[model samples]
Target: MKFTLVIRQGKTQLIGQLKEIPGVLTQGLTIAEVKENIQDALALYLEDMREDDAEDSNAIIAQEEVEFA
Candidate 1:
């Protein structure tokens, strides 16, 4: 998948994040490094999301009784 990165040139490093995904950010010494880091960060982000989804599925109540008093 291709993601747009919003890159910023900082004083000592390059900072970037996926434009569509929040919390997926990273920094590097150069633009190239920043791009690579962004890929890694995005992958980790997706992995975390998958894990979270799995956890949520596990917590689902298969059967529930609605009692109204």
Candidate 2:
């Protein structure tokens, strides 16, 4: 699967983020490096998500209500 990559100029390095996946972000010194880093970051993110789903399947889910200040 392919997703859009967004790179931004940072002070010391380039920052890259996956457009389709929030919180999947990383930084590298060069464009090539950042591109590579983002790929690894995305892979890790997907793996983590899959693990979470597996755990959720065995979890006893519940809801709670409380006032937020």
By TM-score, the best candidate is: 2
Tens-place lDDT digits, model 2, residues 1-69: 567899999999999998988699999999999999998998898799778877887674764555645
On lDDT, the candidate that comes out on top is 2
Q: Give the whole-model CA lDDT for all candidates, comma-separated.
A: 0.86, 0.87
User: Number of clashes in every candidate structure?
Assistant: 0, 0
TM-score of each: 0.75, 0.76
Lowest lDDT block of 10, candidate 1: 60-69
- Flag clash pairs in model 1: none
- In candidate 2, position 14 carries an lDDT of 96
- Give Cα distance to truth, residue 53, candidate 2, Å: 0.7
Q: Which regions of candidate 2 fall more than 4 Å away from where they truly are?
A: 59-69
Q: In model 1, state the lDDT of residue 33.
A: 92
